[model samples]
Target chain A: MTVNVLLLLVIAVTFGAGITLLLERSLTRIVVGTLLVGNAVNLVFLVASGAAGRAPIVDPDDPSPMSDPLPQALVLTAIVITLGVAGFLLAMAYRSQQLQGDDEVQDDIEDTLIMALAERDEASQSWEDDTGGEPDEEGADR
Target chain B: MTTHSAMSFLIPLPVVLSLLGAGICLALGHNARAQRVVGIVTLSVVVAIAAVLLAGAYRDGPQVVHVGGWPARLGIVLVADSLSALLLLTSAIVTLCVLVYSVGQGIVEFGPDTPLSVFYPTFLVLSAGVSNAFLSGDLFNLYVGFEVLLAASYVLITLGGTGPRVRAGSTYVVVSVLSSVVFLVALAGVYAATGTVNMADLSEKLQAVPSDVRTVLQLLLLTAFCIKAAVFPLSAWLPDSYPTAPAPVTAVFAGLLTKVGVYAIIRVQTILFPENHLTTLLLWGAAATMVIGILGAVAQSDIKRMLSFTLISHIGFMIFGIALASHLGLASAIFYTVHHITIQTTLFLVAGLIEIRGGSTALERLGGLAKAAPFLALMFFLPAMNLAGIPPLSGYFGKVGLAEAGIAAGGWLAYLVVAASIVTSLLTLYAIAKTWNRAFWRPPDPETAPPIGDWHPSTPETPQPTGDWPPSRSSPTGTKSGEPWAPTLTAVRQLPAAMVGPTVALVALSTAITLVAGPLFGIASRAATELGERTPYVTAVLEDGSGITR
Candidate 1:
């Protein structure tokens, strides 16, 4: 029971810290955060595999507990995938730094402007609806 | 083996052939000629195989193949039903066209950052990934498929290693990785709850789980898939990142990639969780995606960015149909998916041609293209009109079918989405028309015209006339290669037949959708009916009596 509790707590802390880092603007921090989150998820899979004990080799008469090997296999695959992605992330970061000398992701100009326009459109439409489609009257009141 | 047994080979052939093709393409290295020939020939064979698979699936229900002769419960299974086969065929066609188009763009080399050899291999791998995802019968396998494609896309999107491409590439990679993580978390949860990731097994096991737990799992999966599908709030990365890639890369990405996510969503809702517990959530999402996506499109001055936004909007149409969770809704959505893929790809290709001729995709600096290149003008006009749901086009047939489905559904939300559908359609027309009047119809004003210099194609064989245009200014590397707001200096250079021919072929494919809408709709309905039943797929894979187990 204590082991399970400890594992759960470790997963929580790791995932929380990882996600916090990912939300930061620095590209290096983001890459580290991805690694951390990936490890945290691996730990979760470990915990889900039940009480760990031994390698999952079976003997005909063995009566001892064996760790569920499935999650370990899953964790191994996950780790490899994370490594591949981390390499890609590092390459992308290097290229980004080379180009702009910084790792901050800039907001797309068109995206922000379009989103703002959408908000304005929504506000105006509501106003027209509130004024029973009399937009001139609504504008005058404003 | 009899014909029935032989047909199972078709399920994995496309993916395997494409992978083999990628290997050969890679070995060809900088030999651009060999790579193009290999890509075209390999994809053509894949297309033929896909057509056969589609016909076989339609005639004989879903066909299941287990790799290495293993049991469905223990091994990866590839299932070819009407849905996946249809997608496979459509995507194969689009990718082949885009490959030929890229070859025409003098895309043989791009300095040290991106080599032409890398493009074909990566593209083929991406196609293989897409096919794998569509045909996967299990969740973990599906996740693998997503990673394969996402990794290939990372390479393709940042092909030139230019500044904007890198920036956009990073954002794309981050978003995709985050979604993959979400999918992983959901996969863990699903496995913990039910102890299996085989979707057919989950279909049976999920019912036994507590309702609250099942709902949580369902929502988690939906959230992950939604990010990938670029539905609404999660879609900001799409319009930002997609417009940065080379034109052919962008074209194929817009056409086929998101539809893979939608395919997964349909599989999730129908095969794994058929209760429709999330219908209301999906409806609200559909309405928001449509309205917001088109609104974003309206605000974009750049042609590629506008098309990207519109791409997001039309995904809503598919989601809208899926939200209805009815036969007609699913059928119409399938039809729309096919129509949208062809039209969207053609539009992006045309956008590429326009950029080639005019030197920029910005409407502000482009004019007199109608007079300059009337062929390009007609090409743009048809797809734009088709996309806006103009009559006698595939888009119109798709929209009418969807509207009918919505009315048949007959709820306040359905009515609202139907109305939104109409509004978004008109808005799409308005936006496309705005582009047309500015870029094509209007006369070239000197204020917006680019400086006149002796311009030539940017290939080595076509020698650059000595120093008329500054070499630094004329180097075509980045998305904004030319002066940001300037038009081309000379009359448009003659586009290679390789490029224009594919564009014309794709546009005709879009029109061909209308020519065969009746039979196509029939096929879609049959697919829909088969999907709604669900038992055929589930049993073909899982039931011991089916003899699929090794």
Candidate 2:
């Protein structure tokens, strides 16, 4: 395949996987999507080395061509790293699901902020009610 | 010793020791005692190797070791220079302190079980990866190092699988993965353009490339690195994610991860692409990072969360030095990186101790800790003052050098850096002071204080019981919970010596750095000199002729 064609394909797959992962709330889908993106990136690296013609080992007796070994080596490392990361991510997801009984991440900050505001409002109302509806501003200032 | 043959094997020794350590840890996974012994022994050996490298760099200059005995252009090479040696030394020291700290904290946090067993091996692997990144002479190897460390971090961050941890870990994972992808894409592009990944070769070759294409590569790489470094606009994920991890994990991450990113950017800017355009961009980015990160710190109520923001902010100061691209600037940047790593980890560890004794990291939930835990308060104070760049601290020396470099680099942009750095320093002080006031000064509420006197001897409440341990029995101390001071005092008095020692050690290190600023500055200057002059690195790798082609 031509290098340009391979580049295009890698870009398409990577972006597709990225968008899919972003859209999904499920942790498993996200991990899978990350894997896809990682593979797509590896493909991009391979393609960038110029369309593969032969293996990188230089055989002096052979009449054929030599491929870029550097990119291949890099891609191999990247793949291993990605696999390790994916395994960890899966473990984390399982653990999360076990703890919360759901895979979806809880929006802790948003929830806490909203709850705190609501509690403050209730407390203010109760204070006013207890003080004969005077709505004491000094205590409410906080 | 001056000859290349003698120095080559020793150049990558630290990384080799660390990797070997990782292997041993993994192999003896079932034997917890053996794992701990191997892990600590290996790290100490690695530290010794780092010392050897530092001495070699000091004596004979920078050295490079090509992996698999290949020439520089064809094979992966690890370079040991003053800068690398300095960072390796700092990393080794911090990791050692953290390892010791983890032994104490891990038992409380993870129990004497499988989780802790799993943790040590991964931690060793992560340290090995970090050492590799510092020593690597090629860009591709650097990327692999980053991936290695990052993979280990993901496991460590979400170890217990608690709800908050999982949620935080997901964000951390996504952000880190995205950054790695971006980094990979950038690497591919650079390789496509240059046909070489060797740092020295790229330094020569990148100059021949067209300005526009170079800029594009520079910006792309910068974007990926900025995300990793948690710089300003890219830093929103850090505060949310970091506060949820186990304290030691957070401490290590805060200490090392972003610094690695900064280190990469520094390498690329000074060694590979010494263009004015990229440096100018870095300058502006540094300013913005400083402002935004401090602002985030100001907004946080949790001690760990606030420190996370401050970590991001301090990264700006390091970047500020690199952006100047002057001797003083680069030297100061290196100094700042080392200083920040020590100070930041110490601060996080102190924060962890606070969470352990006070029951929550949130400032609103803690108070009067100073009276109860004077040592902890002192521990927090040293790093806190150091972080604010108070006079006579290492932080102050680093900032002053950067400011001087900025002034020397004189322009409207330089002035902006000066103003921004000063402002950030002050704001950092403000945020830490807020933590001090609320978490340590204010009186605690008696009703909310954990009961101390009604001791149930059968069951000890784990310091942090979110997961991996049984729920803590309701407070044992019964004083009608009327007075908050007594229980606070009791907990303070009960603070373990194991925890207190590490904090004190870090404080002493910071103080020593401040006291001996001259030697530190000299070392930093040598590092900057070595980094700027790429000839030693290039020559060492390519001289053997095995590195010219793949």
Candidate 3:
């Protein structure tokens, strides 16, 4: 029921930067953004575990409370899963670069075609109408 | 008591068996025959396990098992209710058939004798992930299940490392990873708010959180899942990525992946947040998903991309049922989910067959398919109509049930959604008919025409695979000079019997749903009742102490 100001600020900073990087067209940058965002979430889980406390173990010398161990377990699992996904994305990015000379995300063939079709449809009633046949349009897909 | 205990023992077998099967297959990587046998046997056993779990669940309410005999409050518990059990069986059947189809079609990118073919192992892992997700009784485990499947899918989607696939695979991997990050954030929020990630526990505890904070949590969870589900605003990734994969991969993904998201949505909405606070927003999303998705389909010139769009569009119908938040609505949604999974998969499989016979899935590049291969035509025609929700099909029955639920809800938004759904169905029919006309009914394009003026598959002999895939668009053989085109019928390499058999079996399974619609709907409603009421699951997991006490 309590909010930690410092932790909140840190979470906001990291999450904000992650979202910004995520918008880039480069797949590597996107993967970096995903990793940062993942770390920020782990930090959120840390904040959720509450103020730091004595180690959660059997102890006779001290009566300090034990910090919640569940969130720590959750964070560990999250980190491992994020690592595996990051590895896969890196492999894909490397493959992309090797094949196309760059790791930048390419525009979709169908999406570009759909946009062109939309433009032509808008000019359907105009005197300067421009339209093409299926074979030519499909050629544009490649 | 005995039945409950016995059922609990069997609940985790699907996930455990699948993971074990995956490890076995991976070890047998160099041996193709051994890998195939292990993969199919593993899935077959899992199917039997799911069927047994389904019957046990029906006979004796929900079954629960706590891992390592740990207390329900402390450890993960896997639960098998009618809802999860039914989906598990359907998915297992579909996965097996797709595996058979994939092997038959030969997705062996590095030739048949490559030292390491990653296909079977990756597929088994994907099934295990799906099984885990369906049976997970907690939010964190659910997230893990999603990650596992997404990871396996990342490998499957880019199998060949070819230019188009790698490019498409990049977009897909990034988007899916983003969704997983969002899901992780939601898990953090749930743990922070409720202090436990278990669903039955959360169901009781989430109600106590402040309404504003609770709304934030629900919206975060919904956002992550809707992205996975490919809801309207977030759906642009799906059509772009799906069509680029090999055919069998596309078929399996079309069948199972998004439905996992739908299953999550249904679980969370029905169990964790019983009050349905975001009904209006969900209805709006459902309406938009249906309209825009089918609109994209109508605009597509390629068969694979067109089917991908319709896949997104049909997700709307399930969301409509979920948004209604009534017994009948949820039941109809479950029924529709099952129907969509089977039929969409069938359609994609047929699209693969189309690629083999015509050398391309583009409507303009294909024609005279009906004359060329009658069985493949029938395969495509049946699923297309069924998808359009024509009367007498399971799809039609599901839509009617959803519409009835919408009317019963009787709000203007509900009415608008119903109207939108009807419009979407008509648009689906239009798009499908357009594809049929161009791809099957009309004569083969003049340039790629058969040499004997016309030809059929059964005439004397057939031909072979001439690198027709990603069909070679640069060469128009006969059109260059005045030389007539050659007649090449490779069985479409005269449509391979092994591949065609599975596709036909899936199509027949879809028709079988129409025949058995009454009982399936009955089971669906009973499951819905358990879901809507919420006591059966909670009691089985937290209250009844079903887990063995060490």
Choose the strongest candidate by DockQ.
3
lDDT of 3 at A66: 84
Over all chains combined, what TM-score does candidate 2 have? Answer: 0.89
- RMSD in Å for model 3: 5.6
Query: Residue B140 in candidate 3 has what lDDT?
Result: 93
Q: Rank the candidate models, highest TM-score first.
A: 3, 1, 2
lDDT of 2: 0.78
Candidate 2 CAPRI-style tier: acceptable
Better of 1 and 3 by TM-score: 3
Q: Which ten residues in a row have the lowest lDDT in candidate 3 chain B?
A: B468-477
DockQ of each: 0.29, 0.38, 0.44
Q: Which candidate ranks first by TM-score, i.e. highest?
A: 3
Model 3 lDDT tens row, A30-141: 8888888888999999988877787788688888888888899999998998898888888888988998899898999768866886887741111122133333322342
Per-candidate iRMSD: 6.5, 5.5, 5.6
Off by over 4 Å in 2: A6-10, A110-142, B107-115, B447-485, B491-493, B544-550
Stretches of candidate 1 exceeding 4 Å from the true structure: A1-3, A63-66, A111-142, B1-3, B107-115, B452-492, B544-550
Weakest 10 consecutive residues of candidate 2 chain B by summed lDDT: B469-478
**Better candidate by TM-score, 2 or 3:** 3
Model 1: per-residue Cα lDDT over A32-132, one tens digit each: 99999999989878766767776789887888898877667777888898999889888878878887898777777656665686776643121222213
